[model samples]
Target chain A: MEGRERKTLVLGVIGADVHAVGNRILDYAFTQAGFKVVNIGVMASQEEFIQAAIETSAAAILVSSLYGHGEMDCRGMREKCQEAGIGDILLYVGGNLVVGKQDFGPVEKLFRKMGFDRVYPPGTMPEEPIADLRRDLGLA
Target chain B: MELSVKQMDPEEFGRQRQEVLTAWPTGKEVDFDEAVAYQKELPAAKVMAAKLAQGKAKGVTYAQPRAGVALISEHIELLRYLQDEGGADLLPTTIDSYTRQNRYKEAQGGIEESRSIGRSMLNGFPAVNHGVMACRRVVESVGVPVQVRHGTPDARLLAEVTLAGGFTDFEGGSISYNIPYAKDVPVENTIKYWQYVDRLVGLYEENGVRINREPFGPLTGTLVPPSISHAVGVIEAVLAVAQGVKSLSLGYGQCGNLIQDVAALHTLPLLAQEYLKKLGYPEVMITTVFHQWMGGFPQDEAKAYGVISWGAVAAALGKATKVIVKTPHEALGIPTKEANAAGLRTTKQVLNMLRDQTLPQTEELTLEEKMILRETRLILDKVLELGEGDMAVGSVRAFQAGVIDVPFAPSRFNVGKILPARDTTGAVRILDFGCLPFDREIRDFHQERIARRGRDEGRDPSFQMVIDDIYAIGKGMLVGRPRG
Candidate 1:
């Protein structure tokens, strides 16, 4: 256990979102914090993320949506993961989760119900997810 | 390996020119000797290099607006409005998307549609499809010097058509245009194509036409670190000069921080001159252009004016040769003529007010300038080393290895590994310096600054800051500190 191989994480910007800067940061942050990050880059579909996760045997899928269409783009992502037979793969979603400055409490609750292991608001830093991944992956 | 980025032989370039000019109907008229003579007869004031030289000598920051429409007359009208009403000291004929993509048939279709409809169906002026005479019509209609501005991966024919038509200045280079504009266009291909473009400009120079070349300095424009843009701009300048370009205007987009924006303008010309001299092109006349905020704009028109004015201030005080003005309708989409003129007037007002006063070199500004010079030199050295002292080879290889990645460029050729977010003071800092070849001290400087901001915000350094910064201007802020 002390010398176990690095755990994998699948990351990308979901939907027709062409936001690459944030996705790049997540890749670097997770890679620096000691995870084998498979970055799918911008304009990713949910199926693409799950496919990468299943191929890499990733411990989690970190989803970023900056174009404010995350709510629609991310719905049924958990079911897709389950259908892809990686149902238990950890799911983390963040970035302007809903259009406008809608109340975060309900948005977080809604995503949690949709099977996200963690939900980060628009300004949630990457450090928080790195810490969450370490604990969730049993690295901590 | 396919090695490109070398200066093309004149005879070899001539062989290639036949195929390039045959790409469209208008290519028939792009004759070199004829074009060179036409350029020589243009009034000296209408020559961009000469005008930019005067601007540099006078310490004036000329305002230029982006414009073009599909119809020739309509495009001319737009430029005239921008010139007469907007107070634009320089003019641009921005090429349309189809032309930029080399879809001349489609551009032709767009031109016909725009003509029949009595409005431009195309996004910009399709100069290539319009041929030499049509381009000359626009040039003749405009009083000031005209520059051809376009984001084209393969601009060989466009350069031929426009230059033959009487454009005095041309914008964009391989690295500058390819990385930021096209998602999958290989830099090598573009480098080769732009080499042809520069060689055409060189041929004109050989015949005594002093056309001005500008390396699009603001790659991706959104939160790009100055070191990265400077490295690309300086490299592009070298490549252009190798093909005999004598006049260059390197550009930089506003990065929100006054000291940093000014620092960038200061270092751009200084670094370009140093590299040109060191590379044996010591006499290349280098000028700088400051682009107004190229990020998300506040939808509120008043707030937008505030943003434009601040850019004007930076460009004026930093002593940029010209400032590319942005319209208030940035958030709303393509600006109307009135909105565009209003934006230009706003910028001109600020420039007029600040012309005499220099932002006294504050200690912070001095420090920033020193840091930019150091960082830019390191990247350029690595780039040259990568190409084995051949900048053309070096730039392509550097991008291949991610040694000079633009933050959010869509080009698959770009390794897309570097991450840029703002420090506490709103200056862009790298979050991920992977493969950049910066020394430990330089890396630590950026790390500590971002870490300091993280400490103040009660959060750790992460991508969240990048997101916040992306939306900051629209939200009426710059640093993007987390809300309580």
Candidate 2:
């Protein structure tokens, strides 16, 4: 994990959601923006993300969920990571994080309450998060 | 011409007479020649000779059509234009708008338009054109040679009957083209459906013709068990045609409703390319569209799908022979006539500009794109290593359920291992916006999914799709159902 100025990020779509178009775009965009992204593809689980993060010694974990079931599925994932001994790693999630119509304030609060460091609505460009990660890790 | 010249030699005659006698015990040789002669107003002997010659001609000539695109009736004009303008390079790109809803009147318009323009290589007729007359008109009309799709009952029966009657080039099968609507097929039924395709392929080959199976439907959802099985079955049937199946209608993008992860979408195109190639299919028509199943984001978000531009990248990298563009306007409904025209125009424009891109120059990537590319390569490798005795590809669902298992997982990388980044600055740059609110409605939208699955339905659907839920909630749209 050394000598590489670029940070390693674990990215994927979680659970039964098999959406790949956006995931691929994110992969391209992140790589274009100078991040090493390990895209786990579709139908991923919390364990998969944790394992990749741990294995890659990733700078952060970025989860994308397009299916409306993200809230139900992504809940407690941060705790799960803490149990896996990588609690301090940054957690960034975007895309449809819940099912049905709801408010963003409570939604972002909920993800934060669940321990996500940063949350984005669907269509959040990767550049914004990468820039934040750069500043947070003091790479900038 | 003497009667003796038309007649068989005595020994041959005796052999035929005795064989006929034994085959039908007590059957008398009724003077059928007299009846035929009366009908034709010819001598009995001449009539016999003519009947004998007609029977002889029954099984003599046989030729098969080559692999190419099957245009839907609606896209015929645009296809013809693509052809006439020396766009032969685009022939493998299939036309999709001509669904089962339209009639022959619409079909004729495409047919006539193609004829008027003098480019007949574009293949496809209406899904409902099931009779011999319609088939014959289509086959002969766009005579530069093309494959046809038949979905109506008459089309299936006509394809069967006509091929039996010596029109060997006709294609048949309803289930193959209707792949998108079949997500919930019982795994068993799916298996049977594919087995049936083998029989259909054999029938055509018996008539001395080969068929290019249309295994993917663009607007349809995932390529589930049935379609996957048919794809493999088509390969086995290639032997009937005295050659291996060399072309496949794979990578037809559907709504991607079953696809919640990049793994699934990556699976379709990669599998379509490598598996088909491994199974000996040489040509593949890959469709990369931003259809509804891609988790419809608001237009702005959807545009970032990068599928349109990157799809070209993947197709080129995957070595796809053809790529079909889903008109950006398709998520609304059947594209308007203007939209359809614009779609074709965009496809042409993009393909023209990308004709010489020759990207993926270095299949090997720096650490930046390494993990993603490696994950994709590993998946493709696992898909290819599948052997005859192994569980079939159609059983991907079961495969995921641990009914069977592939050797690798998506996260199989070393920890603390940072992959190197390459090509830091590319012309096509992605501009990122800092974190923003979910626009109250989008958040409330996601809450409903939680309430329904979490509180109401008692189903603990994962929250991995928060983005989709938030987006759908904000838009006040739930694709499959109305949220309670």
Model 2 residue B63 CA deviation in Å: 27
| Candidate 1 lDDT, A1-140, residue by residue in tens | 33789898899887645556566667877887888899987767798898899889988999997644576678899999888898998999997665333567998998999999999876566789998888888788
Name model 2 segments beyond 4 Å from true: A1-140, B1-129, B143-180, B202-208, B217-244, B252-319, B361-484
Report the CAPRI category for model 2. incorrect
lDDT of 2 by residue, B1-484 (tens): 1111011234643454344333322213222233222223322222212322232244111111112122334344444444454232222222212222223444445445555754322233332323333333333333233434332211322233222222222232223322222222333333333333333434333343344443433321221211222232232222212122222333333222221112233344444565445544455333222222222433432452333434434333333334444334333322233433344444445545555553342333332133323333333344334422122332333323332211111211101111111011110000110111123443343344344444333334332222233234125343222246
Question: What tens-digit string does per-residue lDDT give for candidate 1 at B301-393?
Answer: 899999999899999989899999998876554567889999999999999999998878889999899889999999999989988888988
Best by lDDT: 1
Candidate 1 chain A lDDT trough over 10 residues, lowest sum: A95-104
List the global CA lDDT of all models.
0.86, 0.40
